[model samples]
Target: MKNYDKYTREYFTPPVSSLKWTQKEYITAPPTWCSVDLRDGNQALVVPMNLQEKLEYFQLLLQIGFKEIEVGFPAASETEFAFLRTLIEQDLIPEDVTIQVLTQSREHIIRKTFEALQGVNKAIVHLYNSTSVAQREQVFRKSKAEIIDIAISGAELVKTCAAQTDGNFQFQYSPESFTGTEVEFALEICNRVLDVWQPTAQNKVIINLPATVSLSMPHIYASQIEYMSEHLNYRDHVILSLHPHNDRGTGVADAELGMLAGGQRVEGTLFGNGERTGNVDVITLALNLFSHGVNPHLHLENIPEIMSEYERLTRMKVSKRHPYAGELVFTAFSGSHQDAIAKGMKWREEGNGPHWSVPYLLIDPKDIGREYEGDIIRINSQSGKGGIGYVLEQNFGIDLPGEMREAVGYRVKGVSDRLHKELIPDEIYEIFIEEYVNITAPLELINYCFTHRDDYEATVSVRMGEELKEFTGVGNGRLDAISNALRTNLGMDYTNLVYKEHALEIGSESQAVTYIGITASEGTVYWGCGIDNDVMTSSVKALFSVVNKLHHSTSTQRLVNNR
Candidate 1:
């Protein structure tokens, strides 16, 4: 903060203002994606990927549906040259995909780049040189005209080399650091390079405008792109491309806005991996299109698998919070967020519409190889009754009643808080079983038989601590009759006995589960669950479980009061 005055805005706005890109609402189609992972991304790595890793990463880019990939700056290193040769010699490059190689504006580098493309079926000869004012004044110490000459000479050499080379080639020119360059000067340099190539309809040239340092807001970049798109030479035969970096953490925004400004192609890395803050994340850009109902044309159905392969090959970890591919992107830990997600999922399941409009989720996790259980509703201390209940119903087919879920949620949250860890589905199930299901301590139902008399007569065998006894009572129903018998023989006074039953649909179809809730004299309701092959037996067990819970709660409270 103290040195804030030391830095000033270095980006140059276009002389002519064109904000037409603002009228467009969204990108109706995905741009032509060119991955620079092997080149820009590898150069930034602390330990550059080996030959084998580059090969594997290239294959991965192919699988992700990149039509054009900048393999590397072949002239920069023997390893880069070898990797390009390996792709060509081993016939690893797919017919539909075009491999690109970066080169400086020098003649030898251009010639060496062409040499690396010796037998390639199709390739793009990418030529670049720094054109920003900073580079002109400090780095290259050259005038704008001299910088333009460098790009033109490189374009001429690349053109001559392509004519002599055996491979099919296209020309690409980048005014490196285009964002910091004056827009008028940037356009002039690109057009001069285009003059040397004279690209045709069949072999259109790429004019890449890279925000090499991301010196301004996204709108300024968009305006600069629009100016170039409108004023470029051989406009019909030029492909406007954007290569944005993440120095300002808005690479994705810059790419999106550039596309909206008539830029056709994008050159970026998989997860924004490159020099410094990294390149624009192609994954984020493509998935952003996908979320807006546009087909990104990339096979991203299994993001986890892609992330694993990327981390393994690049030796870089994808952050757990990374968009669409992170481990916790779909997980909800907040109670309110979990509740909304649970309810939204239910609403969607009931045929709400064809659209994915779930609350707290931009897109369905299952659409990208993630599931609801374990991934969506994570059970932490901040979890709510809705999410807990939804998790139970989805994973274990044990749907807690609406009134009972809150009490169960509190108990589960207490356990998780004490343990200081998230509860897995199995752990949550175990907690449910230990705390609420078939609990028998002070009162246990050893046996029960029912007979139909005037109003459902019941004979029940019960155990209380060390004593076992038999009791009989009649009520309108079997569970009521049993409750009446228990209340009379055990001198337990309670009312409003609630019971509900459902057949277990997950592990055992034949087993029936029943839930019971009883209100004590103090207006507190204790809940319990029971599972058995017979519905009547499960109902009786459930009643006993609730009675035991009530007795334990009362005893614990009395002890606390005495203390």
Candidate 2:
């Protein structure tokens, strides 16, 4: 018979289809989480987060509903030891939040770990060892009995230490490569350790089973989890934990499978930053439940705050395109996506019944701390009539002519292809106002320039519509100087209109297109578009356009700041 470990690594097939479980099979449970940021995430980082950063992160973890935070290995480094000491001496560990420390099964290191948490109010000593065919044969070159002895001796040492400690101490043991280990041998070692510890329902022992080096297909991993779920003994007195790595890029699926197969606890870092392809992402898992109409213990709404704190502490920029927590996760750029999200949102707002739009949205952005209302994100050209009309309908309640949406779609495609970037709201507004809304003749900007020396200030020149209306002023960069020149010539803040530049093209160096929207006393939406090689010109043209929009809207519409 082929070793299932070797066979499973090569090919994995699901034991059953997802449809096998109905709605009744899906039950949300209060999850026990353990963040491996310090140990797992730190090792995986290119430049590891320092002690102070780790301390800040530790506090942030507590602020979130994560009760079990696995701090770094105190036995590893002076920095880790000092940070652990600071965490202990500062007396900051919450009553509910129990600090967990990881150590190898070795006696010296385990004692050093215990020494760090000596006075700490609450602590869990997590001890783990590699226990798989490959690890035993290659890593230690030890037989199965020899490996079990290593683990058993480690647990016995922990029991002795726990008896010695005055403060609250619990023991956690992980069969490091549990997913790939032989089931009967794995159970034997687990039951051996459990017998030594004598864990009860109230005093539950955590047995974390890591998919250490995720080597199986997603379904194989799921089957392994289900098989283990059905086999692991002391079912009531043990907290079955899962720690999956993204070696196969199926860590998320692996976690879902484990949970489905009856895992009560999960241990991972935020965004799954760890060794190799990293660990399973905890944030994604919890929010996945939130999308499925089930609640995860982790608050879905405090995501931004949590991310902000993590960023501040870790000094690592979360990619803007990262799911839910990213800057643009909810933003739709594709025509179909924007159109679908828009129509879905409209249907969602209709309070007559339950929503049918969860198709486009895998998880609701509201589950995380995002403020996206499914507004159709306009880009240069990849938009259809639905998206363009939606934007027009949103900005101004005036519905554009049907043919105009088609024309606008073509124009948008042209712009998108030319710009090579997503078109922003103000940019779309500018194009619409220019092409559709007939603004007879407003402030026409002819040309502008700045002449300045190394010692003195700068000058501004503007040619307004064939009429060379040039104003020379002295100030900083051409933007402020030009604005001052405008105030001097075009009158004061009587318009009560503000113009903000929204980028038409993305990238730091590329020209950021500005659309200036202004309001009138009567109320209207006037928009202008300015594209230039120079950013100052763009800013000035944007202001110039806002001045036009304010003038036109006041004449035709109602007031300023209309949605």
Candidate 3:
């Protein structure tokens, strides 16, 4: 007979081995990608999206193959209700998709929620309220009896309101902050809700006992969930779900432990974009299962499209450090990682990589729309011969001698350190030629001019190698003009060069540096750097610099005598 408080206290603090795992499951594999991005995500935002943006974002979520999406709290705002109504009126929802709205215990709000769902064919009214001691003490400041009363009233209202809808309607209730809630009390209240709704096995009600927050170690959460899993008498009549917040950066771990404890449902947003530290990064979590050979049923190949849509709708930037979908996640900057990935490539060519050289990769980058060739990043201080060699092999299918690779890699690193970024294949070739080929003359750009003004007309001309190369073009910027200059006079084709600039120094007076990553003929990537006080000039120069380097390197190489 464990005291409820004592049992919970113990559950919140447990041993590691009890939660450490070797296997994982992603329900999305069987196609159960639940999107809480708009709901949980909206609440987390300090400046929530406008109603139009919210509607657009909701539609975008469905486009990513999420059959069920948590839209927003209908009971909370008029704007939210309007967003829900917009979805209903437009009939924009897919037949297979279900829209979900959230609410609390107040009878008035629940009735309003019912009004909002009047014409919906399929929907979920997620009823939630805090149930744990932490909520009582810290948030609600209620006694146990008072909290239980709140729970019962809330559950009753949700049932009454949901009955108004004829189509597939679901009632999901969460013992909010359930991670720190006592089992008996939590169970008592949840069981009462079940008794009132009496949801059958086939039409089972969801009892979402979220970790709400990571209260302690993974094992403790596991134990608490396990205890609840074993204690439930009408298990077949309920869907036990878990929603874990990564407050301590272990939301993924806590959720995994809950699944280990028999939880069958998960709730999260893409890229873990939510309040505070965000929810468990669903991409990382799902792919984690994929790495271990569990089919999480999710089409991971759709990640880039999802990322692009998310970035557009949310107007939020995804950090490069973000896992899976981030620009840098699959890239390896360390020499050792590059060496291993390169060897893996060779073994792949030999048709034996799955067993041979696979240390750096847990999953193939190509499976997620990432180029395996880009894995060996030539960043400063950590790059080596392996990175340079791999880049040349990938871009040109030509191998450099090991000794030249070392020398070339060194020169590239020196420039990369000065430039502070990953050098591309053409940049590597330029640096290689500059170091190996004898260049008695350095062609300095004495003067350059590029102007983009008066409704997007642009032009550029530069004095280079004692000759004037002038080119005019119509584009959105001066960089485009300079690229035109290179294409017209330098015998360099105008490859699509992406100019992404960043300020290297702090404050308003800081100089902006432009890093141009160019994709040229034969799919080769070239990098160039430029610095200036003005953004457009820096970007233009960076674009031209790479072309200049490429032309000079090739010409200089041809002039050398092999004999």
| Error of model 3, residue 458, in angstroms | 36
How many pairs collide in each candidate, listed in order? Answer: 0, 12, 5
Off by over 4 Å in 1: 375-563
Give the root-mean-square deviation of each candidate in angstroms.
Answer: 13.3, 15.0, 15.8
Q: In candidate 2, which residue ranges exceed 4 Å CA deviation? A: 1-25, 355-359, 373-563
Question: Which is superior by TM-score, 1 or 2?
Answer: 1
Per-residue lDDT of candidate 1, residues 201-319 (tens digit)? 99999999999999999999999999999999899999999999999999999999999998999999989999999999999999999999999998898887787678767778788
TM-score versus the correct structure, for each prediction: 0.68, 0.65, 0.64
How far residue 223's Cα lies from its native spot in candidate 3, in Å, is 1.3
Model 2: per-residue Cα lDDT over 1-563, one tens digit each: 65655653432333434322223355466458899988898888778888878888887777667899999899999988988899888887888888889988999998888888778888888988888887888889999899889889999998888777667887788888876687666777887778778888777888887888887766566566565556557778888888899998888888887777667788888877788988988888777776667777775576766775665555555665666776567777798988877777777787645743544666667655565664423443434555666675566443444534565666766776687776776787676667533232455666667767642233444445556666655556565566556656765333333444444433334555554444444454445445556666776776665565554445454344553
Q: Report the C-alpha lDDT of model 3 over 1-563, residue by residue, as the tens digit.
A: 55655644323432223333325443333224578988888777767888888888877766556787888888788888888888888897889888888888888888888888888888877887888776798888999889878878888877766666655688888888887777677777888777777888667788887767777877677777766666665788777777878887888877777777777778888788888888867778788777766777666785666676676566565776677766666778899998988877877888873543366777777777777556534434345466676776565443444444555566777898788676777777666545433222333344455454663444554566576655566555556655665566556654766656666443334666666666656565555556678776666656656676566666665689543
Q: Which ranges in model 3 have alpha carbons more than 4 Å from their true place?
A: 1-32, 165-167, 353-357, 375-563
Residue 451 of candidate 2: its Cα lDDT? 65
Q: Comparing candidate 1 with candidate 3, which one achieves the higher TM-score?
A: 1
